[model samples]
Target: METVLIEHFKKARRLFRILLVLALLCTVCIGIAYISIFLYAKIAGPPTLTVPQTAIFYSSNGKVLDELHNGQKRYWVPLESVSDNIKEATLAVEDKRFYDHNGFDIKRIGGAIVADIKAMSKVQGASTITQQYARNLFLEHDKTWTRKFQEALYTIRLEFNYDKDKIFEGYLNTIYYGHGAYGVEAASKTYFNKKAKDLTLSEASMLAGIPKGPTYYSPLLHEENAKERQRIILNLLVDQGKISQKEADKAFVTPLFYAKKAQDEANAKKQDASYFMSAALSQLTNELGITEAMIHSNGLRIYTTLDIDVQKKAEEAMNTVMNKDSDIQTAFVAMDPKTGAVKALIGGRDYKKSPFNRATQAVRQPGSTMKPFLYYAALADGFTESTAMQSEETTFTLDDGVSTYKPSNYNSYYANNPITLAQAIALSDNIYAVKTHLFIGEHRLVETAKSLGVSTPLKQVPSLALGTSPVRVIDMVNAYGIFANGGKEISPTFIKRIETAGGDMVYEAPQEKKQIVDKRLAFLTTHLMTGMFQKELNGYTTVTGKPILKYLSRDYAGKSGTTPTDSWMIGYTPQLVSGVWVGYDQGKQIERVEEKAYAKKMWALFMEDALEGKKKQAFKAPKGLVSVNINPETGDIATKSCSKKYKAYYLTGTQPTTYCRDKGVSEEKNQAPQKQKEQDGFFHRLRDWF
Candidate 1:
């Protein structure tokens, strides 16, 4: 028996020794495995620290017009930019021992393990702010064991690479808050109508509790639930000793404005600036050849030609004239004539409900606004301001061979006599316009429009002179800009320069000048169009412009177009050019007189404020143009004997040389065919040609 007992004891001792050896080997293997993970974590780097940053837009005068994002409005401000109130409140509720632990809280994890087990799922996450940030930055947020293990590895990497402040800031920024707000700054603004740094303790505590379940705690959709969440957060803040019980009580009753009011305020503040952002981003993507991901990730700083004051004035102008009851909507765009810098753009009356950009996209008939192009084509074809056109009833068989159309004046008040080309344009006489259009040919007008930047296709018909072609508002503005800038064709550009977030210059618009129209012809046309100023009434009133001169008293030339549905008023000074359209976004007629006049009134109101405080400038005539007083009755060089005359600008040598005599007749010096041919003048040749 004693021998058997000794043998059993020895066998048990041997088994114990073997078990101890296996345990030591297992410990070494586990240690190596841990070292391998640590090495990999150190090598993998800080899990792509780049978060989506808000793209900033700057106006021409270096003002921040907006901060926008494609998907989420996240403004990644500095760590110091975050208020201590929010920091303490978030730490109190989300991770009470965030700074006390290295990356993970063992005690929280243990408690979460029991709670999750009891709930039969991952109903509780003991994730420290670091672990939460790791999951957000690098790992997929799955509650499975594999994702949690991977999150642990990334958490170690995060703690090793970044300090507490960076981890907390990164966590705050990367964590999602509802209502499309991605970061604390955005969430603060989303909830409280203020910046993150300006958030009060109560606001901070309420926001800090939101990330737990944004939908569940949303004060916008669930006010009572959000109030309960806010109460819990206040209690947490008091328990953490960040605030007193008295403070908690005060914060419990804090009046909280939900995300809706904040959004409304932001929309009211942004106004039409978001539309500009949308347009600018489209251009930036095309210009830089970068993707939307690149725009958000690379942190591009878009410098645009938008003028803040002008944009505001435009918004104010639209608001003043437009109301909810008003059926018509308006599109307005203002640009710099010299550089083609688009200073202001209001695509529609409101951008939120309807984002369709009317200024750049919508195409509508231009009515008499397109008459300038026809007259420009005529001038290019050697027709001068003195060229006379008959406003009598005229009929032309359609080139289609199946239809005949008769064109008349706007009010059907035809002069029944000859009117010079200058008077033809100023008075907007469609009869004389069509007569001159057929005389010069429609193809010439199309060529003129294309040269001066009318991109829309124009049909070759007599009605083409009367703006039969549908045109974008930008098209009219750019085309008229040619006449404003001494006949140089310029493409309207919105972006002034572009840069990376680090201020590396990517693009700057080149000053390109392509002379598409002759300087003399442009000056001649401008002079004739400005004839609205030449008329003097009983009182001291300016006589130039399409009733636009009544408000825009300075020297500017433009045209008014009226289709059955669209009304366009596009004009330009030497400094600025603007186009205003009043109509519905959908194809609908503006039948009311006041709605139609809104286009012109919007133009005058915007220009009246735009040109304010700036020097009142005049357009200087290009060389080779002469200002001469000519007879409106006979298109001849006016003498004192001529009772009715106005100062007219004419192409050099195109000025009428004959003198007006008695009975409103012209006195020719000779009667021979060659002398009669010489005395016939430009107007008579054009008249006889048709």
Candidate 2:
């Protein structure tokens, strides 16, 4: 029995020696691998630690407008700017031996390995701050042997090159904290409405506990869970001797205020300026020769020309006046005429439902709004405001005589008599406009519109006089700005300046102004537009703007145009020019009378609110123009005997010299009207040909 026991003991000793040799060999292999990785990392140098950051947009009022990021909100700050409370709490919860370890915590790793071995699964992680940061910067969060091996190499690289504080700072800056926030600064601002450095002990602990399970410990979503985790972190800090028990207990019971709820409440019912931001971003990318991807990743600071008050007023007006149940879309744009800076822009009624920007994109017929340009062309081509045409329904043979063209006024109502240009404009007389178009040459109106900054293509057709060409709201608003700013054409500006995250200037919009039209003709045309609201110009029909007369508080020159499918109202004061278009997206005809009136009323309401606190400005008349009171019926100079007359402006040589002969007055009865000199003008040629 003793011999048998000795044989068994010898077998047991042999097995033990074999196992010991294998263990030593495994240890030596691991050591060599570790050394190899360390040397390789040292030769590879430090990795590029910089990550994509959030970009900020500022309004003209110096308020933050919005933030742009590549699907994650991240703001980087130095370690010195972080609060000590957060650092201690993060260390306590994530890695207690973070400062002592080279890159991995051996004790924690051993514990995790033992736990995994007992459970027969790799369910536990013992990543130090440096390791987690390396993974965050370099690898995806997948549980695999390959990922772990790569993570170990990067961790060693980071530990060997960067100091503890920098590693900690990078870790804190890149850590995910839920709610799209990827950094401590963003997390603090998201939860507490304050900077990371301003966070108190309670807030710091709350934010520090989120990186473990962002969704599970989100204070905005799971406050109780977050509080419990925060308490655990606080206790851990107490156990680590970083804070006293009393301070931990005090922080555990402190009340916290979160910005998420307040922000949600404020956003519950608000106009989103996403459309304007989209436009501004497009301008930025186009001007800088960069892509939008660069804007999201480069941390640019964009200063835009949006007026918060005006934008709000414009949205409020749209919301207040538009039909809630109807799917009819609307586009509105307001701009500073003097600078061509867009103050407010509403692309569509709702951005989420449809992101199509009608203000800048939609091309629809402008209807009678095109008349002003036609008249401007005429005035420049020797046709005075006193120029007269028969308003009766008439058919004219086209240039190809086989094709005859007939046009009718609104509701087929006309004077069936001679009407002056001033009266025709106030009434939107279609026959008179067509006659003038044919007489002045169709190409002349196109030239006038192009010179006034209308970029939309226009055809030299007779129907073009009645605004048959489709145009964008923004382009039309800019066209009117030429008249408002006294013939200085300008391109609309969205961004005032752009800078890098480090405050280096990237771009600045150069002020571009060119004199594209005669100042006197622009001023005169602007004055002509004002006649739409003049009651004295009422003839066969009330002025088109008569419906909005009660809403006017100050003088404004505007034109309202309507087609079967679209309605437009564009106008301007000396300081501001605005335009609105109301129509269905599918070009459905506006059947309701109230819907047809939406454009005019909305324009009046928005303009009133936008100009509420500003000083009223008058249209300054340029030099070499004559102002006179004229009779609307005769286009003759007005006298004391005329029943109705209004002040009109004209070029120096174009003012009428004959006085109107009223029914009761005989003083001017003997004065025959002076005939225009027979020159090679369009009217004389048309008369001779007919």
Candidate 3:
């Protein structure tokens, strides 16, 4: 029996030895697998971090107009650069052993495991700063055993390959902050309009506390929660010997620095000269293969066409008037007539209230402001400025057969007498303009408007003579610039140049001018129209019963127009052409004032400020155009007995050769009867006597 037991014991020992050997082999194999993964992670590059191009717009003077982002993601930033207090506080609250540990904290991991097991929840995370960065850069945020294993391996690799400072920098730069902010640098600028290097302790601590879960503790959002988190971080910093208890106590008492609302920030950014230029930049970025990220990071020096002083004045004027009434929205566009460079543009009272820019986006009827184009076209079609047309109140039946269209002057007074072309334009008589349009045919008028950069489609109807076509304010302004520019149409351009992020010029806008109309005709039209600003009846009165013509103190010309709702005043000097449109977004009619209040007020404000110190340069007349003293009504050369000897100007082709026989008087009885008889000649005398 003893012998049998010994043999059985020996067999049991042999079985135990075999099982131990197999277990050891399995352990060795698992260790080898982990080591391989760790090595691979150390040598392999991280997955590519893709950044979507941010949309940035600038004003003409290099001010930011808008910044649009499609994605809500951003990178992390270093804690020290983020904010000193924030860094210490965050280190205190999260990963207290961050600086001391290699890659893992066994004590924290053990404690987390115990707590997690007790709560039956995955509430505790045992990730160190290095491990967290490793997971963020290479792995997904999943709480699985396999992911954790991969994270540990990568963390070890990161620790070996990167220095402590680099690892911290990467960790901070890779984590997401709330509010679409990625790194501390971006967050600092976004929240405080400052850089990370300028952050205070409290600011830094607040930023540092955000990454634990940005949404739950965003300073812009839940300030109370953010404050609480900040306090916790401060305490942690105190406990870690990074700061004093008294310092932490003082920090706790400090109020949280709340950031401005997004809308407010957007407004602040736009109140600079570069706002529109930034907008142009954004457009060009897409067209020129440059990205917004490159622009932000590359620190580009963009030279634009904006005059800073003019832009400031425009913004100030708009703000002053915009504050007066809430219902009215005003738009102003100014351009260099010579170069077509947009100098100043105010889209609306506040871009936040309505981002729909009336200057560039809203298409409204230009009202009678379109008369200049028709008049210019008439001159080009061999219609002399002195040529007479019947300006009596007239009515016409349209093919539509809806109603009889009776066009009258703005004052509803038209003499049933012959009026010259210059009189028709100066009086802005709708009937005369419509009759002229009919005489020339609608097709020719449409073609003329198109030739002058009127891209809006016009209907072949008589009503078009009254400027009923839908057009953008910018387009209308450019069209008027053609007359100012001696018949050459230069398309408006906002961007001066676009360069790559690396300082290589990628796109430079070409200044191309096309002659769309005869220089002689343009000059003639401009010469005759300049009369509108000379007289009080030409619509240059002030609100206080004063004449604003003297304030202009220069040779300028413009027209006032109003439809049912919109009021427009477009004018030009030798150097600048500007247009102002005043109306409501909802399209409501405005009461007309003799002073032309709304549009005239805006126009005068823009021009008086825009041309403050400029020379009073006269519009250059094309060669062969001449000015002559004539009777205002007859458009004939004025005699000594003429009642009103206005200096009537006309192109040589359109000037009247005959002098007024009765001088300035329209009726023979107003002048000497014998002189009038002599003016009528012997043939008329024979008929009269018979």
Candidate 4:
């Protein structure tokens, strides 16, 4: 019995020593951990809080236009902006001991380990709010020891540098709440169509439940599952002493209204300004050398040149005038002539049905709109507004001598007499245009178009003068802007500036100008285009713009073009330049007369409406141009006695040397043709030929 007592004493002594060693080892381990954390805190610096955020786009008027993001949309709001209910509900559901623990809850983690061991799987999480935020900001959601270890280190680092409120705010902002929503604010807006600060207890509880298993608890997808999870969260809130039992019961039974319905879900995929936003994003990525992935992830603030009011006017005009049932499509673009800013643009009638940006993408024949470039070339080639050409039917022998080309006027009607450049333009006289195109050489028109910013490829064919080559509507608008802006070349600009999420400047557009067209020639060509609306310029045909003249309240210089498959009207005032194209996408003939009329009528309506409440300014003539009264029939300086005369613009040395011999000419000769042309209404019959 003594020997047994000795052996028991020895065993007890060994057990005590083992306990003492363990205590010392644990103390050393704790010291080492503390030292490592201190070193890491010294090295890691401040918390970056880097997370993907939604990029916002603002209009010129400082209104939010749209937003872009990755699959998950996040809008960061300060802790002050989040409702107390949301904070309470999130704490109850996600981490109850959030403020009590530094970065990890020892008791909760021990409980979670026991629970997982009982389940024989890693089926429980004990992450505190700070740990989750660290994982969200720095680590991926991989179920591995390495990820967990990294998450722990990051959590310690975060706790060391940031206060509890900052870490909480970051967690609230970065946590994924499902359905393409990455934060409390985005979730609130997505589910309730309200700001996060406006969420009630019921809505906050509903949103809070989604973060655990986003897809499983999403109110939008699984309503019953979401309700059950929300009820659980409300009970947790009540048990945590954050809310009363009556409040929990009331929240659980409250009738909830979701922001999105089945149809709304479909419609949300396509919103207003989809086309314009797409174009701006394209420019941002392609032209500005910014990658789309960066744009999606980085919180960028893009300020665009879009005038929201003008954009609305453009849409209203298109819808108001267009036949909604018709399949014929149209594209429109409006710009500030001086600055080259694209204030308004529409790629197609409906962006959802089709995303083809016809304004910048479609290359359709410009028809007679090409004449301005051609006429501009003529003016540079020493051809005045009074330059005369025979408009009778003619076949041109090609340089090869074996080939001949025949071009006819609209409706095969011709002046059958010599008509001045101004009259030819007003009539859209194809015969005279082709004759002049050949006389000056087709290469001249090609050169002129390029100088005016036409980037599309062109063949030096006689029809080039008549705009047979296909060109983009946007390019045409910019080209017309040169004429409207007194010959200064301007690029079509969308984004005015870009800024980082932190308000650092990324890019600011430079207001640059290049003189491509001579100011004198641009003014002279613009002057000739205005003859389209003047009744005095009528000769073999009524002016092409005569049909839309009654719709105009301000002076505008423009041209109209027609092809078998396309109808175009591009015009501008000094302040704005806009273009419209109407046609079938398949290049089918525009058979309907009303469809043919759509371009001009739409242009008239949009310009009038868009420029409303703004100053009505006239086109300013340059210093060297002189205005002269000329006889439309004679292309000669007009006398007071001349029966019909109109003001024409000429360069100082380019005016006609002869005066009109109208004193002895018969009244029938002078007045009869003008009356006949108006009565015929060449543009009224444009339906048959346009």
Q: lDDT for each of the candidates?
A: 0.79, 0.88, 0.70, 0.87
Model 3 per-residue lDDT tens digits across residues 229-253: 8888877777778988898788668
* lDDT, model 4: 0.87
Q: In model 2, which residue pairs have backbone atoms overlapping below 3 Å?
A: none
Range of the 10 consecutive residues with the lowest summed lDDT in candidate 3 = 536-545
In model 1, residue pairs whose N, Cα or C atoms come closer than 3 Å (at least 3 residues apart or on different chains), thus clashing, are 532-543, 532-544, 533-543, 533-544
Off by over 4 Å in 1: 56-71, 84-102, 107-125, 160-165, 177-179, 191-210, 213-278, 285-290, 294-330, 346-355, 396-405, 497-515, 536-552, 582-598, 661-663, 666-688
- Per-residue error for 74 in candidate 2, Å, reads 1.7
Ranking by lDDT: 2, 4, 1, 3
Worst 10 residues of 1 by lDDT: 536-545
How many backbone clashes are present in model 2?
0
Candidate 4: RMSD to truth: 6.7
Q: What TM-score does structure 2 among the candidates reach?
A: 0.88
* Residue-wise C-alpha lDDT for candidate 4, range 1-690, written one tens digit per residue: 999999999999999999999999999999998998889886987679878889989999998888788578888899999999999999998888888889999999999999999999998888899999998999888889999888888898898889999999999999998878899999888888889999999999999999998999988889899999999999998888888999999999999998867437745643367778888988998899878877888888999999888998999899988999999999999999999999999999998799999998889999999999888887787677777767799888888998998888889998788788888998899987887787677899999889888999999998788888999999999999999999997888999999987789999988888787799888888888888888998777799999999999988999999999999999999999999999999999998889999999999999999888889997778888778888887677788778678888878755655677682242223334554454335323422322
Query: In model 2, what is the error at residue 671, expressed in angstroms?
Result: 16
Error of 3 at 600 (Å): 2.3
On residues 474-496, what C-alpha lDDT tens digit does candidate 1 reach at each position? Answer: 87898788888888868878888
Question: How well does candidate 4 match the true structure in TM-score terms?
Answer: 0.87
- Better-scoring candidate (TM-score), 3 or 4: 4
